[model samples]
Target: MPADTARGRLPGFFYRFAHPALAVVSTVGSLLWLAGFALAGAGVALRASDPTTAYALFYYGSLVSLAGIAGIAAVVAYLVVLWLLRDVLDVLDWEKPEPGARR
Candidate 1:
């Protein structure tokens, strides 16, 4: 046998850092998206006073919300896939490269 030539798993702290950072990033991204919702709400609420301005604000706010949500979802999905892949690699002893090889 080749003695399972893979290197040892990454430290728990490293995994912790990766996961928490991803989560924080996801949350911040989502909050950025929610800001669009707030802006839209403000625009609608103010429409009674200024229809033209409020209409423009609402359109921009909706666009921002859509873009923000899409971006956040993409990022979160990517991170989740990486996290899952890491777990699978750990389970299968695939995280580390072959023996005697650079990472």
Candidate 2:
């Protein structure tokens, strides 16, 4: 077993970072997305009177929304990785390298 495969589970470093990553993606990401929605709605409301400001707000909202979407995507990716690694953390002998082969 190599250092990366310590104890047949994900690296300790990954665990240490995963918590903060999930927190940022799940919490802050959601808040940003909602804020984007609010801004875009405000833009729509003001479009008739102030097209300039409304367009600016709409542009900003789009950018913020994209950022939020990226963050949320990261969270989903983390879930998928965790799901794939579930057995790795559970079963110690799930994988056994074959060192000998005759071909």
Candidate 3:
């Protein structure tokens, strides 16, 4: 088998750097989403006492939540594309050349 043909193998830079970077992004996205929900809840609690403040909190919280969701979606889409490409490459057997062929 070629060096790149091992199952679950990724390029060195991707495995070492890109994957970890995406993981961190995913973690941050989730945290931001959670914070948005907390803020929105606070807005709801304050709605009766301070309508203007509540509206601002709700609006900003929704924007933050949407941004977080978009970030996570983008990361997931990238990963899915990577997975599909890997599967297609595996199916094509592109890494294995003729047995006697020279490198």
The deviation in Å at residue 55 for candidate 1 is 1.2
lDDT of each: 0.71, 0.76, 0.80
Query: Could you tell me the lDDT of residue 78 within candidate 1?
Result: 86
Best by TM-score: 3
Off by over 4 Å in 3: 1-18, 89-103
How high is the lDDT of residue 70 in model 1?
Answer: 79
Model 3, 39-103: lDDT tens digits are 89999999999999999999989988988898899899998877777666554333644888765
**What does candidate 2's lDDT look like per residue over 1-103, in tens digits?**
4655656454344455636558656667788888899999999999999999999999999888888888898898987776666654653344433667422
Highest-lDDT candidate: 3
RMSD, every candidate, angstroms: 12.8, 12.3, 10.5
- Pairwise TM-score winner, candidates 2 and 3: 3
Candidate 1: TM-score? 0.56
Which ranges of candidate 2 are over 4 A from the true structure? 1-21, 88-103
**Compared with the true structure, what per-residue lDDT tens digits does model 1 show for residues 33-90?**
7988888888999899988888888888888788778767877788667768777555
